[model samples]
Target: MHADTFGTFDDTLASGPRRTPLHALHLRRGARMVPFSGYDMPLHYPAGLLKEHLHTRAGAGLFDVSHMGQIALHADDPADAARALEALIPADILGLRSGRQRYGLLTDAAGGIRDDLMVARFGDRLVLVSYTTLRAPETGADL
Candidate 1:
């Protein structure tokens, strides 16, 4: 897979967009590269958006999501971590079991949404998938 095949770069921009780990691979597979979330990702493969969406709905599809931010919380006990996260997001984090995933919303003091994220419990740690495009919580104290 050659990076050159990943689509033409936007020379008009001040700087080139960041490439993901699968940039070359996507190009080799005839993917159409597009700038998204500060990364050059595949907008759709040769299969096109409709077929790709249908394929994902019908079975499964692989996507390169290296642009999203990942936050890991560690604690002595899984329950403690879950509880700590529950203070920040309006979701049943304490009720989430190992290997379970849930959608959560991070809200401000005024009850406005700061962002949406995905929370998953795995062993004694909690993994959070935060969208880079949305504002995030300032600190643990803010929760």
Candidate 2:
């Protein structure tokens, strides 16, 4: 109950919204729930943001971010994976080194930014993921 209604920033202030599977786990962890961006999410935990941030900086905050936005790729070669990712991004996906990551942007033909996102080579496939989805329709990539 505390996690469900404990903080001024809990986006879960409302009664309904989409929740990831971690919702149950967060509830079990004493996270303060709140509403945000059309979803129910946690604003902070029992220690509060200030302490949580400090602990993280102090190396005492072991974190589990399994519930965060994640994307995976499956391909036979790095080139193949980069090609697949390139189909959606304007960035030179093929230029990224095997273990490196790069920030990518999707832009319209007119040069307007559609979205800003990330792309990385994981294993042999190109993995592109972002918190926001945007697109230029033709390229179908908004980062």
Among these predictions, the greatest TM-score belongs to: 1
Model 1 RMSD in Å is 8.4
Residue 69 error, candidate 1, Å:
1.0
Candidate 2, pairs of clashing residues: 10-33, 10-34, 10-35, 11-34, 11-35, 12-34, 12-35, 134-142
Candidate 1: give the clashing pairs: none
lDDT of 2: 0.57
lDDT of 1 by residue, 1-143 (tens): 00011122233553767787789999999998888755788888897889999999999988665555556666666777677677778889888878888988877878887777777777655554444432322422243
TM-score of each: 0.76, 0.58
Model 1 TM-score, all chains together = 0.76
